[model samples]
Target: MYYKGVYHLFYQYNPKGAVWGNIVWGHSVSKDLINWKELQPALYPSKPFDKYGCWSGSATIVPGQGPVILYTGVVDKRSNEVQCIAIPANTSDPFLTKWVKPNRLNPIVTADHNMNGSVFRDPTTAWLGKDRLWRILVGSKHDDTGLAYLYRSKDFVKWTRAKHPIHSAKTTGMWECPDFYPVPLQGKNGLDASMIGDSVKHVLKNSLDMTRYEYYTVGTYIQNKDKYIPDNTSEDGWGGLRYDYGNFYASKSFFDPSKNRRIIWGWANESDTKEDDVKKGWAGIQADVEVTFSFSSLDKAEAFDPNWVNAEDLCAQKGSKVQGGLGPFGLLTLASKKLEEYTPVFFRVFKASNKHVILMCSDAKRLLSNN
Candidate 1:
């Protein structure tokens, strides 16, 4: 998160070993988002609340209280998951290098006897409400149902679980790393977590532990009712739209107040064998950033159909002659250099009744090699 003049990043790490066991939050700071300097572990197992391990959570900046971190902690050897909080040891430190968990308020929220303690983890960033209460969510599951449990606080310390979950889905298994925030309905700018109005919409994204894919829905937050109702544009179940079609999970997004945009971070699982992982001494937990480029094989194929064209010439068009309205625009690939065989892989955005629908497709037909 960008705070003060420095960008602070807190991530799950194992200080005692290279592998996933001895969990703690490794802290790092940067002036520019690129180059970073590592600081001491921001959070680790110390008290009874997080004695076993320290896990994922989020940071929130309060108006006059500075930044507070809400994280899931393994309370005992049984691996009971509980929500906990940490405060900066010195808010004056520009990097906010040190943090301390108050014992009195440690393990601020514990699972009820009827709730499954093992699956509860990953609290989202907290947001203030119209009722002057601070609210947050913790991911959990109950007998094949994924849940985002809601908890509210008056002072960001003591938390009380709501009568019902903020949201849930049956047969989806556990929901991990749940994220909730508001976005401008018509603009690209991001809204603060607490922002609510007719011009704004809320998005709730959850990483499905069973499928290892992140699913999100654009919805409305009925503040008075404390419920989220997703628009009909997307499904809110296991078969819903995903953040990525492949290996990405436990995603987190934060609004960049500085840039007026939202930034997302996710972990990508390694497809390689375990033998290869131990040899490398690490697993694939990484930031996700991708880019794609398209080119035609034929130099003069400007028809924009399944015609062959050189990639260079197509890119040279610079979108000058391209018509734009939720484009399925992209280059036709696997085409013969003579402008013969090709396939189009593109994305189209459609205006739905309540939201925009994006569809990606690749057209491959039986084309004789001779052609």
Candidate 2:
């Protein structure tokens, strides 16, 4: 009944022959949020508003309506303000054929009065508390304070402005599309921000929270600004927006009403990641995760050492109780993934963190290769 089902993904892609990238949104179809099939583009950038690119954005299912889209329509560098574009989901072939044009209500947002009008873009949409109102987290001010500009809307189309910007150092430095919503405690990382993110620890009872992964991208927004500080912050108290480690960005999440989940994924490609561009082969890859979140007693759950099991040793931990998990846990490296199914492939940090391993069991895969 949901056409493409509960979720669909659209990312910035540069097809066969275009400028290095001309802003065509490559799409993928998914029903279970697990397996995904790469489909042709769903949207293309040609019009005056988004002539340069149809950058990152969010998709909202409109119940009796349709998929009300809210995305950044990035124009040329001369005036690169991201415009808002909306579209209905059931409009195209979706396999590699025609693309859908946005509706008449284009440019729901243009430049912001608060930040540098030019850098203010990448709209992350979500419910603004219980007001039934909506909010867009626009990353702005690359010229000086780089911050996530907060703009609220009563109807998805109309807009309002927040009293303050997320001026915290954590939220500054060229903050791109920011996805925000309250989530429950994930696991335990002491009092650190990881406390909530560490929530994937207990029984695999699915909740509307990160049973596994979710994150945002960041750089120094603007030499840090006092205005960006949260209201609750005291001079000494620790408070500021936190980066999702490194190596993630331009991310936005959709609030799924049907499933009661706020699922998200990032481009996984950043200007900073330019180093790995050559080594990884693919210019960009989607974050290998589907996330849900909660906001209750998050620490009550027992955490699992997701990275504890090496990809090759997945079978070994089949029945083993998990110790504190680590990523790329023990030989779960890319080298081990060449053959067949990799087990216990619960979480991948992508970059080598504490948890990265690829210990092989049979060596049969390697034995033949060595021959």
Candidate 3:
């Protein structure tokens, strides 16, 4: 979340080790988003609400009250999750280095009688509606259906759960780091979380815990009804449009008011084993890559096979080496001078009956050496 004149980042961190236990919100600030300076752990297991662990959450800049964080906290050994809030100890400070959780509303929202506490986590950035209520989503699951439970607040303190989920789909399993925001239909600029109208379209993204991939749907948000309807243009279940077909997960996006665009951050799980990570003294890193592709035409594109329902399976069958009408085109990274060994990150386009099906593959299978 960008605050004042600096960009603040709060992430799940293990202060004791490199491999994912003893979690807390590690804070860092940057003037340009490129270079960062680390701060003390922002939120940790001090109060009973987050005694077990301080997990994933998002930051919202309240209208009058500076920035406040809404994150999931594990309350007990059962791994029960609850939504909690934290405020800057000193909002006047430019960096907003210190933070405190108020006892009055530490655990602001929790699982009700109908929901399972263990599955509820990752509250999204709160957005205000035209009716003057702040809305937020908490990720969860019911049996095989992934859910984004909706909660509305008037003062950003007290909140109430809606009768039904804002959005959900079956067979997706647990949805983590759920994000909801609006994007302008005609321009490249991004809209604030609260922005809604005929000129803009809404987006709902979720990280599937079962598949370890994330999918997003561009659609309409019925604010008055507290519901979201995904467009018929794409699938909403397991076979859906993914942000990345690779290891990206738990992504969060925020509108960059300074730049009039949105920036997304995600975790790419390490390819190495935990034992290897411990030996290296690091487990994860954040990355950003931008690429432009040019194609002559789709006239020669290969016909897409309807039987290729699973993207991962399709990529496995027709890899980068396999040529096609429109693709098997992209860059080769970490390559040797001889071209005998390299990792190919590319895309393949298959001509479906009505629309084109694109497959993005970052194949490390052909990588000959780690060096």
Q: What's each prediction's TM-score?
A: 0.80, 0.57, 0.90
lDDT of 1 by residue, 186-224 (tens): 978877898988989899999988888888889989987
What is the C-alpha lDDT profile of model 2 across 1-371, one tens digit per residue? 12444457677777753224566777777777778788778777777778767776665544355556666776676757765765654455433234455556677777755456566666654433344555556666544344566676676776766666644232224555555444434432212111112232211100011111222222221111212222222221112222232344455555454555545465444443544654554575554533543335323233445554233344344322244232222322234446443222333222233433322222212221333
Candidate 1 Cα RMSD (Å):
8.0
lDDT of 3 by residue, 1-371 (tens): 88777999888889888898999999999999889999999989999999998999999999889999999999999999999999999988998888999999879998998899999999999999999999999999999999999999999989999999999998889999999999898979987899998998899999899988889999999989999999887789778888878778899998888988898888887788889988888888887678988777878878988877667778888887778787788888869898779888889888899998888888876855553
lDDT of 1: 0.80
Give, for candidate 3, the lowest lDDT window spanning 10 residues: 362-371
Model 1 segments beyond 4 Å from truth? 285-371
Deviation (Å) of 359 in candidate 1: 5.8
Candidate 2: list runs displaced more than 4 Å.
1-4, 17-20, 89-103, 112-114, 166-171, 185-246, 255-262, 269-281, 286-329, 336-371
- Give candidate 3's error at residue 22 in angstroms: 0.7
